[model samples]
Target: MTKTVEFYFDLGSPTTYLAHTQLAKICADTQSELIYIPMLLGGVFKATGNASPAVIPAKGRYMFQDLDRFAKRYGVQLRFNPHFPINTLILMRAATGIQLHQPQRFAEFVDCLFRALWVEGRNLNDPQTIAAVLTENGFDPEEVLALSNDESVKAKLKENTEAAIKRGVFGAPSMFIGDQLFFGQDRLDFVEEALRQD
Candidate 1:
C-alpha cells in the first residue's frame, strides 16, 4: 500500500505554510500520498490549551528568525505577514469546502491562500483584500465565501478539528503517518523518516 501523510494545517500558521512548501516534494521523493486536513488552529488551541509561539515576546521574535532560516534552507519565499494572527475560520472552511466540493481546485485554493498570506504577506483578515487576492488568483471570492457558510462544510471543518485534538494535535503543521504524529514544520525529517519505514 502507498504511504499517506495526513497534514493537519491552518493557513494562519507561517510554519504550516513552510511545511506546505516542502510536503509535496517529500511525498514525491518517498512515493507517498499527501492529504491536506483543514482544521481551525483556534479551535485546536482552545481544546488543547496550547497557544502559538507568537504569544511570547521572546519566542515570537526568535521564531520568525528561525522560520526565515528554514525558508532559506528550503529555497522558498516566506515573508512574515504584518497582519499576524489572521483568523482563519473562514479560510479553513473554504479549504474544507473546496476539498469536499471542488476537489480539483483544493490544491489551488491552498496554494493561493498560503502564498497570499505568507509569501506575499497580504492582510487576509480584511474581506476586501481577501476578495482582491482571490480575484487576482481567478477565484470568485463571493462564491468561495458562500461555500464557507455551507452547513456541511462547516460541520466537516469542526469534525476535522475535533479529530485532530483527539489525536493529540496542539498546533498547526502536524503530520501523521499511520499512528505516529509529527508536530511542527521543523519535524519534517522525522515525517520523511516515518514514510520510509514500515
Candidate 2:
C-alpha cells in the first residue's frame, strides 16, 4: 500500500525550500503520495511557542554557512535574498487562493515562487515582483494577485496555520507519515524511512 505524506511548509523558510526540492524524488522512489500543505510559519510559531533558529545567536550565525554547505551538497542553487525573512502574508493568501481555485496552478506558482526566493534572490513580498513571477510562470498575474486579497483566501490561510498548530507542528518543513511528525529539513531521512516501513 502506498503511504501518504503531509508536508507543511512556509516559503519564508530556507530549510523548507531545500526540503521541497528533494521530497518529490523521495515520494517517487517510495511510491508514497506527497501532499503539500502550505501554512504560515509565523502563526505556527506563535501558537506553539516556538522560535526560529535564526533568532538564536549561535544558530543564526551558523545558518548561512550551513545553508551554503547544504545547497552545494544538494546541487541546488541558493542565493541570499536581500529581503530575507520578508512578510509572507500575501504570498500565503495567494497560495491558499490558488489551491482553492486551481490546484495545478497552485503547485506551479509555489515552484516558481520558491525558485525566485531561494535561487534568484527575488523579493517575493513585492507585489510587482510576485506578479512578474506569476506571469513568467504562465499564470494570470492579475487574477492570481486579486485572489491574494480575497477575504475567503485570507481566512483559509489562517485556518491552515491553526490546523498546523493543532497537529503539533512547531516549525516548517515538517512531514507526517501516519502519526509520526518529522520536524525540520534534516529529518526528511526519517520521513523516508517511515515511508519504507510495513
Candidate 3:
C-alpha cells in the first residue's frame, strides 16, 4: 500500500522551513504522497495553550544553534530573519489561496515565500517587500492579495487551523502518517521510518 504524509505547517516557523527542505526528499525516497496543509501557528498556539520556544530566552538560544546544525547537515540555507516572528496570517492565507486555486503554483509559492523568510532573510511583514518578492518571482501581487482576502479563503484558513488543532497539532511541522503524529523537523527520521514500515 502507498503511504501518505499529511504535513501541517505554518510558514512563520524556521523549523518548518527546515522540514520543508527534507520532507520532499524523504517522500520521494519512500514514494509517499505528501500533502501540504497551511495552518496558522499563532492560532495553533492560542488554541492549544502552547507557545513558541522563542518565548524562553535560553531555549530560544539553544533552538537556533540546534537548527544551524540541522541546516548544515541537510545542506540547506537557514539564516536568521531579522524579522523573526513574521505575522504569517496573510502569508499563510495567500499560500492557502494559491493552494486552493492555482495548484500548479503551490510549490512555487512555498519555495518563494520560504526562501524569502528563511534563506534570504527578507522581511515579509512589509507590504511593499512582499509585493516586490512576488513580482520578482513572476507572481501577480494584486491577484494574490485579492485571493487572500476572499471570504472563502479566509474561512478555509480558519478551518484548516481548527482541523490541525483537533488533530493534536500544537506547532508547525507536524506530520501525520495515518493516525500517528510526528511533531517537529527533528522527528523526520521517524517519519521516514514510519513511511517505510507502511
**Model 2 lDDT at residue 188:** 79
Task: Give lDDT tens digits, candidate 2, residues 1-198.
Answer: 789999998988899999998899999999999998879998988888888887788997698889888889888988867788768888888888889989977778889989999989998778899888888889888898799889988888888888888888999888989788998887778988999988
Q: Is 2 or 3 the stronger prediction by lDDT?
A: 3
> Root-mean-square deviation of each candidate, in angstroms?
0.6, 1.3, 0.6
Alpha-carbon TM-score of each model against the true structure: 0.99, 0.94, 0.99
Q: Candidate 2 — which residues are off by over 4 angstroms?
A: none
lDDT of 1 by residue, 75-99 (tens): 9999999999899999999899989
lDDT by residue for model 3 over 118-140, one digit each (tens)?
99999999999999999999999
Q: lDDT of each prediction vs. the true structure?
A: 0.95, 0.87, 0.95
Native-referenced Cα lDDT, model 1: 0.95
**Runs in model 1 with CA error above 4 Å?**
none
Better of 2 and 3 by TM-score: 3
* Range of the 10 consecutive residues with the lowest summed lDDT in candidate 3: 189-198
The clash numbers for all candidates, in the given order, read 0, 0, 0
